[model samples]
Target: MTANNELFILSASHTREKLKQLRRTHQFFCPQCKEELQLRIGEIVVPHFAHKKDSNCPQLFSDGESKEHLIGKQQLYCFFENKGLTVQLEPFIKNLSQRPDLLVTTKNEQYAIEFQCSNIPIEVVQARTKGYLNASIVPIWLLKTPNFKQQKPTRIQLVQISPFRQQFITRHPQHGSTLLTYNPTTAKFIYFSHLLFIHGYRFIAKVQQLPIAHQYFPFLHLKEPTKEEFTHYWRFHLHIRQRFLRQRFYLSRKGVQDLLLKGCYGARMRLDQLPLFIGLPVRNAQYIDVYIAEWQATLLFFLQDCQISILQVDDEVIAIFILNNPDYFQDERGKDAILHYILLLKKLGVRSIHSSTKEAIILQLLHSEFLAKCYEN
Candidate 1:
């Protein structure tokens, strides 16, 4: 909450500068609870209203706002104001009992914009979003931009998407899936879209940054990647996939039965000899909470256990695997990842489905020139 800039009511809002000068002559009260508020002015911190030590406000409470949050909210409010949109800072809604950082109104719809700069539980985000949606108001959550040492926004980059960050991921009709972040110091907005989930906590995202002054209300969507760009992405994906497998083998304890390595040994296959289709990217694979290769290998091992081929794979097999290995999946829908992976396997195995031996299939399917080049280096 940007306490410095919240309104006396929905109609009357005060700036920090106004609050600073008015502190000597006037008193302020919370907009929601109507309790007397102490105007806190400081040299380092921004001028804002604070509840006295003993005061209690049921509608809202001070969470000790950070300077970054205060400034960011203020800037966003002004940015929306400059666009001639009806915007309110920290409007306390009666029905939802939620104080959105900025309540924006357009001709036909309302939106609750939360400029989240601090780490909060995902449950809080979910509840707030649910509240807004239940009230027929859309929720837009923008996080603080992370510090990227040498970020190249033009191309795909490996970014750490922590659990907290994952809560902000949203889908736009035009943008597909996107996460928006703002940098107050630079006055720029970073858009992360077309997320390609690599593994745990890491993603290959298409990143772009726009100056706040040039930004528009209905944010611009990142264009889909071209064939050349996708080729480069797959090359990078292959590189990271190999690197991840090597790290797993190297990092596993000597005495521990490593799932991936053990599966490979049991199948009489080397890491390099594994099918190219095993670790290929699948939609929603990230929700499985396991390495793409590891889980995909598990699917193959399961098929061997059932004495079946890819064509024989069905809902029963998938259900049984999911039931037995519940830890790999993060949610119920995570089972879809296995199904999607099987679909991809079936597509790849169209030519090799009738092959007699697993070794023969592996040898026969090494025909993708692109994949061959990717794995060779």
Candidate 2:
């Protein structure tokens, strides 16, 4: 049997009992293609409509809906509907020729909620987002929560946010960058907020789980990481950074060509001896594709070659560096990451016209407690 749960084009939604009674006499059609739809209410799956065997609709039924997707869609529909909000399930927008899983409308905004389950290309995501934006509809993409290891609610642990998952990271005004995901099995909304990247795809983040009953339309605003929580995060970050340094020495095959290694070689410094401030966390560091150490270390090397001391570096100089090395910095915000690293250095009082004198400041910053030095305003 087809797993597709393409809904019928109807003015109002109905209960299973009502739908079953109507299925006996009334006929339903696809909203977009105007094709006949079959109502499938089985013991195993949630009640939904599907296209016939021979029907080849261009939209709605193209991608087969998974059990999780169907259940989650229905759950979200009820979740919003019960809140007395205007919500449409599998509504086809005529102008854009796009059918979002759920189109939610509030007093100020209309949002197209895409409950994505399967892996799709980034181009498809961009295209859909562009279409929604052009039609003046905000697109909120939610992913099915992956099977992650259960951790204690109080503990801070390292979680893997793969490259694909990174695309869904959205920036909120009050909170920092966050990714929202839903789990159908438990009816929970798992939020990974204030994500601080430690290494490639590995991040030390603040996670919160709320039952569907407690979840709000505009997600509940999370507070900033407390000082105690940040202390734990820094300790975990140091652990991961040490591991990354070790991996580069023994596991990595790239010798001279590697950016970090090349910088260390040029500076005549060992991996362990490298400055502590080089890999420290920066806002928008996620925009750059490489690790924090790789870009920051290379920036130092570039500064040395150009005879431009770290004390003299400014936004224009960093922008020029980003332009010169396009391969390393893919996004425009990458320049911001580099500048923020410099800002951190300035915060730590790293000032010297002489390149040789930087070691003293570096050593001081390295020996100081991370929380005291970095967290201080």
Candidate 3:
């Protein structure tokens, strides 16, 4: 008989009445709830079992149920063992410690294969692979057929492998075949026979092959940080610094100014210092020196967002001051000034006041004093 016909016969023959007869001969428990089970097959759908009314039964399985999954796992184990591969079968790794369906090991390699019959969340699979990689073990995820169909095994299209350097295999449900490849390399999926004898079989099976056009580091596909994200990052940094060192000063605006100066004076400085400032628009360089000259004005404006309290002066609330411009302070000194300013604000409830020239000179003069104050009781 055809595969579909065979499935129909198997499903139809195991009707509620037939299951009832079997249960009468041998009592059975609900796979989900572990309560006493009663056969309750539908005339149209496949046969199923229900539990007693008081049972706390959840939906066991959507496709073939637990019994079917057990059978499938057993059959798969047999198939692999028959091929001379040492298969560690069913609940491999033990005690819910991220056990895979099968753990295969040879003289030179080891692999963890997850047989996913139902469609599970991709991220869950990815996380599992990540955990496996941390343990120095490689993972191969396999999606099995829901029921034994006569059609070809689903085409296993490899997804991603963990450690970004391992092998992975994925069997597409519809096509009934597996795609196998490794990580950190742009290798194509060859026939299963071709892969069986390859070195690092375990690691090579879990990773997806990159296309020829893609470069090694593909973070270019990641979304650009939004303005709001940049703001949050700056706030987070401020909070972290405050918690660790007891200081309060807005780093975000300063960071922007630093970036602006770097872009404006790129030719005069080394590229290593470029990242000292980030998030400034490349085109804003021309106006940067002008903005730096008006540091106090910018600080007054940004103070509102920083949530620092200010005394009202000339119809404006102003509390803090910007001591130096990006050109005045080297990167290390700028960092030191920022930390010192935060500690001073936290302790004295007063902000530092400085002209642009004093701001420029204070770093060299106050470096030792600031460090002493920071460490003093």
Maximum-TM-score candidate: 1
- How high is each candidate's TM-score? 0.80, 0.78, 0.27
What would the C-alpha RMSD of candidate 1 be, to one decimal place?
A: 6.2
- Residue pairs of candidate 1 with colliding backbone atoms: none
Local error of candidate 1 at residue 17 (angstroms) = 7.6
| Candidate 2 global lDDT | 0.75
Global lDDT scores for all candidate models: 0.72, 0.75, 0.37
lDDT measured at residue 176 in model 1 versus the true structure, 0 to 100: 58
Error of 2 at 164 (Å): 2.8
Rank list by TM-score: 1, 2, 3
Count of clashing residue pairs in every prediction: 0, 0, 22
lDDT of 3 by residue, 10-117 (tens): 232254676656656655554334556555555554455445665564443223455444444554455456567877653334333566766777676677766554
lDDT of 1: 0.72
Candidate 2 lDDT, tens digit per residue, 1-377? 21144544322255667767878966777766677778886667667778888677888652367888988887888888888999998887889988898999999999999999878999999999999999999999999998866656664667898789889988755566678899988889988877776656888777888899998878686676776777677677767777778788677788877777777777788775566676777766777877777777778788887888667998788878888788877778777777767876776765421223353454344334332323221
What's the true lDDT of residue 27 in model 1?
A: 64
TM-score of 2: 0.78
Among these predictions, the greatest lDDT belongs to: 2
